[model samples]
Target: MNEVLIITGACGVGKTATARVWAKAKQGVAIETDYFTEWIYDDSLERFTREEEKLVANLSLVTAKEYLAQKMPVAIEGVWSPYGLSLLHSGLKKKAKNAKLKFVWLYCEISENHRRDELRVSENQMKQRVDIVSQQLQSYHWENYVHHIDTTYLTLPETLAAIESK
Candidate 1:
């Protein structure tokens, strides 16, 4: 059996940093969902097409299975919603025996101004995405299976230590 850690959060919430530290500490592979799609599309900068999104989701499932088969600790970092979590659980249920799945939600209660600054988004993009994200708060509630980490004011090293302690 393999241990899999799924680090999910909104964009610019430090998923990449957490993934980097977690992978280094556990000596596991870090798989970013964006990169999975980027390889398929051969363009990381362009907006993801509908087909690209589907392909990435499917590939994420495959990657999970592969990691489990190798008995390697895997870290999947992405903006995976509750629906995505359901899909992952379903995909891995048959392949893994007593699969150890851990969900880490990177909760950063950053103000709109700070978020805009940190994300480095243009005013137009900020208004579009931030407005929707703020209204919906898509990343706040997990499906009763996620461990919460309030990253409002933690440094990278401190955050890494917190995860290591867990």
Candidate 2:
């Protein structure tokens, strides 16, 4: 069946990498919402606000729907909130009801997250608590569609296996 993989997490959690691999495997497109978010990023804010999420989700919904309409699987990686997913999920379902919707929420130890952040280019460096956003997400009650992945020590291939096997 055609699928839409929503790969979400905080900085340094490997969402982008995993989504890319997954998309390639399925011969699909990987939509990274970071591009959309970056366009409106204000240094004053800590992370994305609800209004920002709405804008990002709206555009992402349109993109995902377009790919799914072509009967291609899609993987979307982003730092998304549960509320944003609720909106995107509904919007996607309305347009592509038969597609399997899978949510992959990647997480890691704070220290590990920091270590990964250190490896990133200076332009993409984390300026604040990677833990805060990720932790806040962990606190929420995730539904059945969501899959939690603890990537404390896993390599990229191992991480890919974990996601695909699930």
Candidate 3:
């Protein structure tokens, strides 16, 4: 059966790298929502807005549906909240009855998150938006569809193993 893995978390939680690695290993498609934003807006991430984010998310879902329609596994990486994930899950279920849907929420301590953000190329923007990240952290609500992974001290391989085990 085909599968759609939605890798979601806060900004610096390594969703992009993890999803890319997982997709590569599984020979599947890795859909990074940021690329959609870049393509549609032709601007930097700092200029991204809520409307643009929603558009990118919807486009990612569409891309995932297309891949599942072709019987391929797809991994989507983004900063998706519970509501957004529910929509993607429902949409995928309606699009492909037999396809498996998995939601992985990667997390780390606030300090670790800040450290990672600092090392990022977009650190300036990330620093300026710390409040937004804090809000995202506080707003996340878990449900049965989600598998949470705390990656504070784990290496990439270890984190991958944990996800696989889940």
- TM-score of each predicted structure versus truth: 0.72, 0.91, 0.83
- For residues 1-166, what per-residue lDDT tens digits would candidate 1 score against the true structure? 5777778665556777788777767767888996774354322333345555456657877887787677677788876666666666666666665777777777666473246345564632333443343334443457776777777788878776666566
Pairs that collide, model 1? none
Per the 3 Å backbone cut-off, how many clashing residue pairs does candidate 2 have?
0
Compare the candidates by lDDT and give the number of the best one.
Answer: 2
Better candidate by TM-score, 1 or 3: 3
Model 2, range 54-94, lDDT digits (tens) per residue? 99999999998889878889998998888888887898889
Q: Which ranges in model 2 have alpha carbons more than 4 Å from their true place?
A: none
Ranking by lDDT: 2, 3, 1
In model 3, which runs have C-alpha deviations exceeding 4 angstroms? 38-54, 122-125
Q: What is the lDDT of candidate 1?
A: 0.65
Overall lDDT per candidate, in order of appearance:
0.65, 0.85, 0.77
| Runs in model 1 lying further than 4 Å from the true structure | 37-55, 112-131, 139-141, 164-166
- Cα deviation at 106, candidate 3, in Å, is 0.8
